[model samples]
Target: MKTFISSLLLLFSFNTFAAPKSELWSYWNVSNEKNATTISHQYWQQTLDKYLITRGEFTLFDYAHVTDADERTLNSYLRQMSRIDPREYKKSEQYAYWVNLYNALTVKLILMDYPIESITKLGGLFSFGPWDEEIITVAGKALTLNDIEHRILRPIWNDPRTHYAVNCASLGCPNLQPKAFTARNSDKLLDKAATEFINSDKGVLIKEENVQLSSIYDWFAIDFGSQQQLFEHLKKYRPELKPFKGDIRYDYNWKLNQQ
Candidate 1:
């Protein structure tokens, strides 16, 4: 009976779901830098400037007040993003492009189905989340949020800070910065975002004698390295976490990060 139950549990787990394959990882040469026109993220910056609201360490979007103009501007930005070939630009530019695209697309999806409690509530049957759906086609290949993160950004850059940069439109996730990430300031922006998130309550909690952390660390454990590495990473951002040593728990809030 135990064996049967284990099999059933495995079948139901979202972790068992396979993602669609894409050539994004193999196609781009990260080391090669060719002179090319930089992709402009002006429309994304405008949309963010209009809707993003900062509250302490967390940032929320005024999803309820998103006007028709906002929608148009967001659509224009996505369209513009689709036209560019990531290979032409430098690696930093490509990194910023994918991060901005992932975030902007997330906001677009949330706005499309506004008034939802969480992004996980959207999408069709048996769809654990919208991350697997092909939301955009770039360079003749359809890309999903999962593809952009796992296959492209995370794998290509191998930077754990990438997790802090992409917003999932949830209170549990890191704040979506009010400014679009640019090649010129990607490093500073990523570092600042990591620091902000680590120090925020959403990232870590000390209750009684136990330590609780965001489920992000659990979900992307490989990306952040081992548990000890994660603790070290957290300490690097917030020195206050250094003294906490007890049973570790992880939690995440799926509530829409809205105003």
Candidate 2:
């Protein structure tokens, strides 16, 4: 009787606690190996490459609606992430979680269908749909983007770089970094992203006399420390932009970041 009871308990445990489909992060590992420049770019290139090679559509995976990704695979990845102990997770995981949630949610949105407009268009109850609050089991806790951002990321770490990492799936937002986020590499990745975006024409374009920048700067100026500090950071990469004296302006495109 004891043996049978023990076996039954073990079987029940496995059934109840067996790894789900949302905890695996291996995709990011495969993605990182494909590009050396930065984890952010590697992530983008890998997804794009895979989609282009197999599906012949770069924008197909842009929404969480119509992605070809196996939901079982994604759910498994999320499940593993959920199992990570909060204490064991380093401070950098805060940033990593933000990035992960953003990417995962973005992918989830794209998987639904080829959305023609902005993700915000899914707004409802508050402004966004269930995707906004939809919970995914992570680190043994079921959490939504709101819980990840507000309860975990924002509360644990207050770095301004976070603003750059949580992309809104729009052109005006910072390009989503493409690598699996880690504590050791997050700072470098964030710094690199900020610098690249500020210098990129798509981010902050300084065209001789006319300067056009991402509205992110205007929306989250507080996160960048100050306007001067933000510009200084940008100048570190593009010295040419430093001397350009022109009207500083922001341009925001609501178009979805799909190709």
Candidate 3:
């Protein structure tokens, strides 16, 4: 019947378009906590300083040039990260932890199987990316890169800037900062990262009369509130990018950000 067919079609549409619910992890305040220890990010800092090359607005890792010693250093850093208890840290420290962990794990994943063109090539069964795999364990909870970004950071902070903080190791992503994010400097680092990305050609392209934005704006549109909100967010960072009227399109480059 017409009614039953319509009902089934609507159900199918809903299922297809639905966004998965994210889990909210507990994040404690850091302000006024005098006893909170500074989480050491020296290892990540050293690796990034030695390997990351800044070209214009984006930074690329010297993946091909990495030596066995460098790989061992990265593994040791990840091991140190695994042993830390995130719950004992302040919100600022936890924020840095999750962002650093996500970025490090991504780099490690690529290093495990280097010489790949894109991250999509590392997809698992029934998944288009390596985001769903249990890549790390911290605070006794097994977490994937997706879990760290979505479940822990996004839900806990409800901040759009969080997206800019985690590098996806792709040309299209925000640059992986040359220095590791620290609790003492997280606020300044987040703002600087967002500003740098928004002003870059990779973030927003205005050619002739058309505006092409990074696919990040489209994929995580909800985090940015609405299209108007997204535009406002961009303008907030780069005020000169305003007062233009044009058609908009979204694009992304999945090629490895390697030197």
In terms of lDDT, the best-performing candidate is 1
- C-alpha root-mean-square deviation, each candidate: 4.5, 15.3, 6.4
Query: For candidate 2, lDDT tens digit of each residue in 15-109?
Result: 44211112233212212222222112233334534432212211223343324455545555545555644343334444565577556666555
Q: CA lDDT, every prediction? A: 0.84, 0.55, 0.82
Q: List the residue pairs that clash in candidate 1.
A: none
lDDT of 2 at 184: 66
lDDT of 3: 0.82
Q: How do all the candidates rank in terms of lDDT, highest first?
A: 1, 3, 2
Worst 10 residues of 2 by lDDT: 52-61
- Candidate closer to the true structure by TM-score (higher is better), 1 or 2: 1
Which 10 consecutive residues of model 3 have the lowest summed lDDT? 26-35
Q: Point out the higher-scoring one by TM-score: 2 or 3.
A: 3
Candidate that scores best on TM-score: 1
Stretches > 4 Å off in candidate 1: 1-24, 30-32
**Residue-wise C-alpha lDDT for candidate 1, range 14-63, written one tens digit per residue:** 56544343235676554447665677999999999988898877799999
Error of 1 at 17 (Å): 8.2
